[model samples]
Target: MASLGVFISCTSDAKKTNDKAKTVTAAGDTVATPEAEVGTVREPVDTAKYDALVKKMANGDTTGNWAGRKGPYPLAGAILPFKRIVVYYGNLHSKKMGALGEYAPKEMWSRLNQEVKHWEKADPSTPVQPGVHYIASVASGTPGTDGMYINRMGDKQIDSVLKIAKMQNAIVFLDIQVGLSTIQKELPRLEKYLKLPHVHLGIDPEFSMKDGSKPGKKIGTYDAADINYCSDFLAKLVRANNLPPKVFVVHRFTRKMVTNYKNIKLRPEVQVVMHMDGWGEPDLKIGTYRHFIFPEPVQFTGFKLFYKNDLKKAPNRLMTPEDLLKLKPVPMYIQYQ
Candidate 1:
């Protein structure tokens, strides 16, 4: 559960749009060759680099839990220890949701780039990859017509986020807050966007409310079965489309958020990141990561820093990249809200 406070205000229309994303057309209005068909760019893994990455991922883990020996080497084009992902996370409709929607696109990208540079400088060895994590399905307070307390963002909104991310060639992660809905229902509708090469995925167990409880009433949970379903879904996409491996991020702050960690299967076509997403002072946040995240061995690790919620208490400051680099199994994916 999140030791947190952030209003998840969602106002986007649930109806999806029919227009093609910017990627589908050229300036002359000519239909471009789809990325999925043209992308046969899976590079074979190098053993030496893989070993070094495993070492960096371990970050001096005496327990030998990290650099998990799960599945297989990430299929070609996986972005992880080779490149640190720095992302702005939020919804475009509500400033309360996160930094991605709190500022203008220009201002947000500028601020995002600053942190990207910080990570780049802090760990000169691992370059930073910029990204935008948009909340595609926001858990809501009231159940809509579908009886699910969630507002789903249509293609138009997702396209706007894509345009912003393209500014820096940043990757995009569509985050889902399932509310009363299940992953089976939510993920398929967004397949058009997920099929895009530059786009990835994030599933928040924080808002997964599986027990018919309203969102924000209680923290929710996702069993390893839920996670395997998502990973399997992505792996099939990779094989069918011949696209590179996709990065799959799962948010967690408490052990209950993600149960049966060992049973969450992995694949070469998908890289799983168990992201620590609680908000509090530095000490509390660190403790949350150590207790809930570090102990369980996931494929890769991610850390989320709330720009506002994190500094509400003493030691009123954000965790700098330098400060975070000290963490065991240093986070390969860093998100700012």
Candidate 2:
């Protein structure tokens, strides 16, 4: 991770004032005021260039040559008002793999690496563009279980994922499943990746547990204080890096997962997108969003469709872009399982 700091520069000018009441000036000569020293003005970034880049991204055309092409596509202004949402659920750790069963013991770590390679190779047909954001689980083991924390792949994995994201032009949301650990404790360790402009944070409160309780059974709820701490830290981190605002993702299934959400103070600099991760029947999922989330001021809501679960239900409502747009505050991201 690069050192987080703001860059500032100053320029100075000096001017002399004429104290004499009588001034003999040449014809057509204007008297100049004593030069007062003025501070140097920082040059503004080429916003037009940035806008053009954004337009290219929105049009799904990330082809032009750019000078500083490092991480994922800059999503500063690419996100539209009522665009469809796409959410991805997966972990880098082998033990906590996705339900796809594609990754296994010996190959789990290599799987993500290989997946990124595949994604890069298929960028022309299936680019990991900005419309879809990838959520990589940092904490290993089960969602609610406590276990040893490891980056396993270290910086190599982080760089690999970031490069893939850049090539695909997608955002990376670091999913933090806080188990026995507090949000405060886990944040610092994940700060390395969060420093990246393309990276954001996701909180799985379902996995958050009370001081002394069982993991799976304990459904932790974040009070205003907890949410504030997380948001504030992220906001500062983003500002320090001179990057665009970071999006904070909160997953909610049952009401208990997010209690007193109305009271949580959202930081102006940070975007708080509340997602409904309820996976089940389509009607039931819609009902959950309508009853609990629609009335709130959340910017976005998320719908998760299980390949096996939702596919079996009656009517088999798999949420499409059209179904999501009908919601009051349309979901910004849709999670596919």
Candidate 3:
């Protein structure tokens, strides 16, 4: 379950726009195309040189300045130099959620690689980090026998995403949408997965039933206390396992999706990202980011793209990688649904 903007339009204009663009994919397949033309056109990047630079940076060679910033924030043990992270979000079996779930797993990975490569070419200095974000706990309309309005995905389902993430050499995020369930009740169930070095966590406030209403009846909220609780939880795990700092993302588009922003604390072992998850035309999205996400700062920031919902309006255009990169405090994490 997500904000009302997420469910707005269901037109196939995005596909029509894709056809008109006739853009080629990195894998040599002409799949969905980029929405806008990038301004900078340069010689094809010397990837071998790029890879060598990456290796040097990994070895603690910090002589040259890199584009964007090598994170002071550590994800998966390495201080990733690039600020761009392109993530595909959804479950393999669900249709209501997104395009990540619309295709088979292998096909999905192929598409994800295409986006990753697109960002790599668009901003040669900031190589995109690929990730798979699975909605592990779905919000339910009815409270279950345990009185929790969240339905946890089976272990096999979680493992499937993990396996695919490993195939891409990418990180994995288990997203939670707590309906009536408290974070205390739902978070521990994913501890086994969280223990894995590459696995991170995401929480959606849209379905958080703070007032005992159903999941989709009204927009929900999570205060700073709740965020602090989750960060403390992850910090413990990071220290206990000697793993890198965990990436904790909170999904928001509306101001109310997350409350008491001033009080949200940061931890050495946890990187908090305030992700903009609203869907609409390009201008609306930028405005949403500017008003809701930009002014309120966090450890890091993320933006989400909805394959279908983003194109619901007629005469609409999607935001290109370059377009999003231009945002103030440019989003470090990018998710596609």
- By TM-score, the best candidate is 1
**Which is the better candidate, 1 or 3, if ranked by TM-score?**
1
Writing each residue's lDDT as its tens digit, candidate 2 over 178-290 gives 55567777777668666655567777776666553434445556665677788889878755654455777787767777776667765534667677766667788888876
Off by over 4 Å in 3: 1-83
lDDT for model 3: 0.70
**After TM-score superposition, what is the CA distance of residue 48 in candidate 1 from its true location, in Å?**
2.0
Error of model 3, residue 324, in angstroms: 0.3
Error of 3 at 229 (Å): 0.7
Per-model TM values vs. the true structure: 0.90, 0.62, 0.78
Q: After TM-score superposition, what is the CA distance of residue 279 in candidate 2 from its true location, in Å?
A: 0.5
C-alpha lDDT values of all predictions? 0.81, 0.49, 0.70
lDDT string, candidate 1, 176-201, tens digits: 88999999899998886777777899
TM-score: the better of candidates 2 and 3: 3
In each prediction, how many residue pairs overlap at the backbone (N, C-alpha, C within less than 3 A)? 0, 10, 0
Q: What lDDT does candidate 3 reach at residue 246?
A: 77
* Candidate 2 TM-score to native: 0.62
